[model samples]
Each structure stands twice: as structure tokens, then as C-alpha cells.
Target: MLVTIVSLWAQKLFRLDEPQPFGGAELQLTLLAKALVKRFGVEVQFITRGQGPFEIFEVDGIRVYKLAYRDFPPARTILGSWDLLRLLLSLKTDIYVQRGGGIETGIVGMASRMKNKPFLFMTSHSWDVDGTHEKNRGWIYGTLYMTGLRRAAGIVTQIQNQHDLLWHNYGRESLVLPSAHEIPAPIPIKKEGVMWVSRCETWKCPHVFLRLAEALPDLRFTMVCPQANSRELFLEISQKAAALNNVTFLPGIPFEETEPLFATHRLFINTSEKEGYPNTFVQAFKWGTPVVSLHVDPDAILSTRELGVCANGDETALRNAVKQMYCDEGWWKKYSENARSYANATHNVQVIVEKFYSLLQSLKK
Candidate 1:
């Protein structure tokens, strides 16, 4: 089987040289591509823009062809639909996959439909809470996505939460493919303290975690962010952490380096103001680390998932939850086990790939 991906924005936004460059969705893509090539021995090629033309990379015995898209300035194909269809015909791909309709998917889905190609889109972005852009750009981009989803051959997402939310709001139904990663077996278990995987931005609400650090001085805090913003915003956060000695502000790490670092922390924290769903919950759990999160959504990660506790409402409630994680070792062990089990069940690679592969088979007829 052959899969051709239509994604330009994912390549651009995620390829930044900052912390948390690729969230859970991007990581899910990399893992899926690698596995499809190596384990399943399928032909996989990705369509992208800006990184120059088509080039091939071999990693872990898997082949990846990056077809760099270059098109007109007015913009025909800037949104991705026509140009991607052109690529699909030229490549003779059996299936055309779109990773959300942000900007690129809009292009890809349109192209796929025009050509009568099997179009499958994976909705990884959390549309409800972890929404992007302001009004003007958001509407432009959102319009593109809504249109794309409506015309897609089929749709997929990591968890039922995001999928259900999409169905509730837009009435779009997509297959639930639990996002998975190739978690590395640790060389050494370094249980230092607690850590957070998020960008230091307005929506993420990193300050809430800093407040927790303030209320609990003894515990160490290791926070990572790749989407760095302006100097003013950086300084404001720095000022908040100036007096605190236990907080370690680490820059974003690449996708290749995330797992080992995740293994070292005893617990992972999510203080996001909103989230579509998160990759950190899976990564932290893959390494047997428990998670503690502010009430974002019950779908992403939760107490029942065995990942950790979820607190809703105010900042004080979040703080109290963190203190309990440290004090209750027995409870922590139970949660740690739950995290691993949940991660394994939801994110099993073979299971979801078969789900995707089957959809393509059905679409062909």
C-alpha cells in the first residue's frame, strides 16, 4: 500500500528550533510514518513546502521522501488543494492522507476529492480548547478546515474526546486512532522530580505551574517550551520565577530526544489553559511516570486513565492536587501503573495502523 500525506503547515510550524516544536499529533505522524515503512514495508511519501525540493531520508531502515511543494504566488495552491492533487497524480499514491485541515489539509482534501482519490484526514489538533490564531486568521483557517472535513473520504483522531467534540460542534465523524510513539527503553531510570511539557504561552498558562512551585518549595520543577514568544512575555515569566530556586526552565527538545528525558522525571504536569489532547500524557506514561493536570478536558488524560489527577476551576485547586501527588506515594504507584496500561491500550501502533489501512480498503471500492 502507498500513503501520500498532504501537509505543509505541519512541516513549517513543527520544524521550529524551539522547545515543544512537535506536540502529540506531530509525534504521532513521525511514529506512524516510520512504522509503516519499516514494519509494514509500505511505501510512504510526504508532501511539504519550503524545505527545498523532493529529498529522501533513511532512518532505522525506513525510507521517507519529502516532496517539497513550490507553486504560484497568488496563490493558487498556497492553501494546498490543487498542488497536492497534482502531486498525488504524479506519485500515483493509493491513499492520500491529510493531517488536519489547518492550512495544508484544506489544500490536500480538495485535491484528493477532485481526483476521486481515497482521502483520509487525521484530526489531531484539539479544536475546542487548544485553538490557534486570532479572529481574522482563525476564521480563514477555520473555514478551510471545516470545508475540508466535510468533503473528506474519511477522518481520524487520537482519542474519542476530540472526535466527539468535533462531532458535537461541527457534526463531523472520524475514526479514533489512538496516537502512539516508539517509546525508548530507558538506559537508566532517573527519577529526579517533576516536569512539564508545554509551550510558555498565554493559553498554556505556565504561570499556574510556577504558582505550584511557589506553594511547594521543596519539589523541583522542570518545564519545557519550544514555542518561545516575545521578549516581554519571556521576561514576565522570568520575573515570576526569579525568587524560586527549584524551577529549571529548559528550552524545547527535539522529537528524537523527548523519551529519554521523560523517563527521568517522577511525575509530569499539564497546566494548559486548554488542550485538544496531549502527547506528553502518553510519553510520560510510556516511561512509567504519573501525570497531574489542571482541568483541561476529561478526554486528553485523567485520573481514570491512571495517568494522574485532573483538577478543574481555580489555580488553588491545581496546587493542592500537586501537593497530594508528592505526599501520597502509594496512590502515585497506582497511578503510575494506570498510566502505563492506558498508554499501551490506547496507543498500540499495530492496532491503529490496521484501522487506517482498513479504511483505505473500504474507500477504494
Candidate 2:
């Protein structure tokens, strides 16, 4: 029997095709979908949010269905939910997969049960599995998400931290998987400048990075933050970065355009308070560039493998670590080589997709 997997997420179909708003989970999903179709011949599809009414289109090998409806206030919420349910049931795939925590989790779960299909929940952030989402996202969002999470046939976590949290908090067992990435051939490029890339959200602490840039006036800094949650906040951060001569602020760039930045940047910095194995980290590592993170370590692989430095939530320490990575060539080269080796060994898309395929096949039995 042929296995068809549907990825349910409200995002663009592909990374390079659109300069739109998307996160690490969407990027990982796109990579996994492409690899599954190319290497294993499994049929893959996507249900995303777009500008128009319900429509279907094909990009690469995946068929994408767009759901464009507002979930505003009293009555439209019900209409929106009904429309989403109709779309989910219409797909009728072998398995339905959703990443991150949202009301769609419950919606997809209901559709899967109605269709007798297995639903897979992929954890995309630490908050999704750590029992904090209930308090963070409020009770209603949590209730709907938990309903779906409990109904999931299988769960996949990007790190052991999420797996442990899932088990401890909810008594759910999950397979630990790394975020998938396409491992590009090694290209020699002159690496310079420090780069920080993420959505301009409050929790991301983009302000801290500005301070780091101010502290180290000699080294050039690049910020590729896209607007997230608030556009006014994005403009605010952009203006702040513009005030500093050493810092260059970009609203955003295409996903394909970022790899060259990663390859040529001397350091990749992450200021997020928490994450689920950031795709940017994998990108930097794959490009043989060292990372300096403010908080997240994701399985402590950064320190364990000497791939990068984790400041452990201290701003001064983060600044110092970036300075050290930039100034010390021997230290920087060592981390860069280790990062590339670890990323290629663990996150190769073909290998990761094979593991995902095996899991999906087992579910069929």
C-alpha cells in the first residue's frame, strides 16, 4: 500500500520561493517533505494558510492546499474551525502530521480519528512539550492542544530535553529526532563579521544582541530579524540597530540567501530564551561557522562537542564568548570544524528522512 503523509501547518509551501513569515518548524517540515518524496517515494502534501479562498497548487513534488479564512470574534471562529475541519477531512491521507502547539492540533486530531488515520505530533519548541505552554498560551489554547497531543499516535521531539519534559509532565513517550537540513557541499569562503538571525519577538532578546554589538565596536554585526508578533517592535529594533555604526540591520532575507551569510560569517549568535534545536544553529554548523548562544544549548551538545559557547543566560558572558570566538583563531577554527562534523553526521536530510519513513511505516502496521 502507498503511504501518503500530510503536513498540516499555516505557512508558505517552500522557503526559497517566498520571502514570507515562517519559523524553524516550517523549514524543517519542508526539508523532511522534499526528502521523503525524493528518497523513499512516499507521497507528501501540505495544508497551509494563504491569501485567497481554499485552493490547491503544486510546488516541487508536494501538493499544497491553502486555507485562507479569519478566526475573528463571535461567529467567524466557528466558521473558521468548520472550514479547517472540512479541509482536513478532504485530504484523507495515510497519516497527518502537525508541528508545534496550536488549536489546529485538536482539529487535525479530530479529523484523523474520524478518518481512522494516525496523527503524528512533532514538537517544534521547548514550550510545546515543557508543560509551560498552558500558562504561557492561556488555558483554552492549552486545552485544545493537549486534547490533540493526547490523541497523537506518535510524538517526535527535536531534542532529549523535550522528550524528557514530555514524559515527566504528560507521561508521553516520544522519539528524539534532530531538525533535518540539506547538507551542502563544503565551499571555501572568507568568513568575517558576526550574524544574528531570528524573528523579532520579545522572547528572542534582540536587544541584548544590540548591546553586544555596542560592547565590541571593532567587529561588524549583522541582524537578520524578521517581524514576528509585532511590526512596530520590528521597526523599534531596526532603529536601535541603525544607531550603532558597527551593526547592520536587515528586515529579512530569503531562506536560500541565508546560507551564504552563514558560510561567510565568522560567528552565528542566538539570543532566544528557549528553542527546539534551532534551524539556524544547524545552518551555521553545516557551514562550519561557530555559534554563541545566550541561553539554549539543546542537549548540551554545544559544550559537549565544543561546537559553540552557551552563555547560560548571562549577557556579559555572551558578549565575552562572542569576543573570544572572534579574536581567537585557533579556538574559532576548532569549534567550526567540530560544528560542521557534528551537523553533517546528525542532520543529513536523507538519513533523517529514512528514520522518519521507518516510523511512519511502522504506524501503518
Candidate 3:
């Protein structure tokens, strides 16, 4: 049976969230796809709504069809399907695989019915993803999230924490496919000072780190953020951090450049409002970099150990956490070790991939 991954974000040029040469969803897909192809000899194809152009490429020896898509309003997230329908019919896919969570699930399921294909919808959340911010987007949008979720042939959640929510609200019937990331071998690299890595969006709370920089003048502060139109806000942050002689700014480097950065950075900070098992935190663990992040529920691995000080938007607490992390010295190492060990055991790619392989095999039977 051929596996067709239908996604809206898969693109040709590589967007900000695209798998860096190092790792991300694309890397995860690549690893599993290569293994599936080599071991099972199953055919794997990808259908994406990438806007640029339509073409094909060999990613990790797997075939990807970069189908072009035009922009649509929110309705498509739930009911609309243009190329997605076309790809499904053309390939007569046996199993449809979509990443964690997205409103596109319903439309894909609809198309699958038309083409007689069953899909595994991977729901990456406990209740709602992270902040559940989509609820505030609009009434119809919120309803679509649930509508798209409930009608899937099968559901797959990254963590067991989310199983009850899907089972109760969406009628569960999903396998628990825990999240995973490749454990990059330890890289001997040098990074100096405190570092924060993530999209430079408002949700990441870059301003909070600016406050930390102000509080700790002696320690070095570095932020690696995507270069986007948020220049005005970034400039404002840079100025605020400037007061601390140790603070510096670096452009958003590609994932390939991140190993050395993660290796060298003494500390890692996660300032996001929400996430479904962050790629950055896994990188931090692999690199032995500890993080101080705002509270996010899906990261149960970090939350259980309390290895990460989950902040609830408390600036004073943020200040104190920074002090404890840097000023105490030994505290940082302990937390870093904790984060690394947890990731090594719990979220290792091989183990997680085995879980996925089991689910696929079960679906076949």
C-alpha cells in the first residue's frame, strides 16, 4: 500500500518551519519514509499545497509531488480541496497520512471517501494544540477544527496525554504515536552565553528575554530569530537588550548552522505561547542546552520532571529563573542533563518510529 502525506505547508523553496537541513517535520518524514521504503518497500508520495510551482523531487530517495496551490480563505481549512483531491484520485492512495493537527483533516477525509482511501489523522494535542488560540480566530473556524477532527478514519496523537480528549470529544479511535526527534550525536562546539532560539514572533515572548538581559548585565544574551517584517518590533527589542553589554543579535541561521549554536550556547530559552513538542527543545536536549520556557501542556516530558521551570507569564519569576540558571552555575548543568536524558529515552526517533510502524501494520490488518 502506498502512503500519501497530504499537507498544506509542504513547499519547494523551504519556508521558516520547513525541515532545516538538520531536522524538523520534514526530517522526521524523511527518516521514516526512507526506512519504510528500504525495509517495507512501500511506495511513499507527498501531496502539498505549495504555492510556487508544480514539480517533483527526490527527498531522502522518496518521491514528493510539489503541487501548486492558490491561496484561499479559512473555509478550505475545513471543506475545500483542490490539488488534494486531484492527488488522491490520481494516486488512488491506500493510506493517507497527515502531520499532527490541522483543519485540513476533514477535507482530506472527504476526498478519501470519494477515492475509497482511508487516512490516519495525527492529532497533536491534549485538548487543543498548546494555547487553543484558534478558538478565538472566529466561530466558523473553531467549529471547523472539531468538524475536521471527528470524521477521520483513524486518529493518531503524538502523546498519550491527548488520547482522552480525542476519545471523549471526537470519539477517540486513535493510536498513540508519541512524538520523536533524531538524537544527533554530541557535537563538540563552542557557544558562549545565554541563547534563545525560535521564530521571532510575538507569541515567543522575545520581550521577556529583553527583560532578562536588562536584569543580568554580566551574562551574554543572544537571540536567533527568523528575519521577517517584524523589524520594528525587533529593533525595539535590540535597543532594550543593548543596555546589557553582553547582549548580541544573530540572524535566523538555517538548521544546519544550529548544531554549533546549540552546542555552544550555555542555556536555551523557550518563549512560545504554545507548541506540540517543540523541535527546539529536542535540539537543546541533544546539545545539552537547558531551557527556561513558558508553560506548555503537550511537553509532558519536560513538565513531569519539572526540569524546565514552566512559567505562566511571570516576569519576576522569569528574572529569578535566569538567575538560578546562570548565577547558581551548577543548577544549569543539572537541568540540561535532565532534559537530555529524558529526550534520549522517551522521544528517540527509533522508538517513536517503531510505534508508527506498529500502527501502520495494524491498519493493514
Structural similarity to truth (TM-score) of each candidate: 0.83, 0.94, 0.82
Report lDDT per candidate.
Answer: 0.66, 0.83, 0.65
lDDT over C-alpha atoms for residue 50 of model 3? 54
Show where candidate 2 strays beyond 4 Å. Answer: 1-10, 13-20, 69-78
Q: Compared with the true structure, what per-residue lDDT tens digits does model 3 show for residues 215-308?
A: 7888888887654447777677666666667777765566667667878887777777766666677777777777777655454555577566
Per residue, candidate 2 scores C-alpha lDDT tens digits across 1-365 of 23434343435444233434788887888888878778887777787764556777777788777666453543434566677788778765888888888777888788878888888889988888877767777776778788889889999999888899999999999999898888889655679999999989999999999999999999999999988768788989999999999998988787887888998999999999988889999999999998999999999999999999999999999988998889999999899889889989999887898899898887763
Task: Assess candidate 3 and give its TM-score to the true structure.
Answer: 0.82
Evaluation by lDDT, superior candidate among 2 and 3: 2
| Best-fitting candidate, scored by TM-score | 2
Ranking by lDDT: 2, 1, 3
lDDT of 1 by residue, 1-365 (tens): 87776555345333443222345555666667767776677777765544565555545443445555444534634534555556666676677776744766566667667667777778766653134422345666766666666677777866777777668766777777777665444424447677887766777877887888877889998777655555566667766766689988765666556666678788788888666557777788777788777866556457555577777756777777777876788887787778777766766677666776677778763
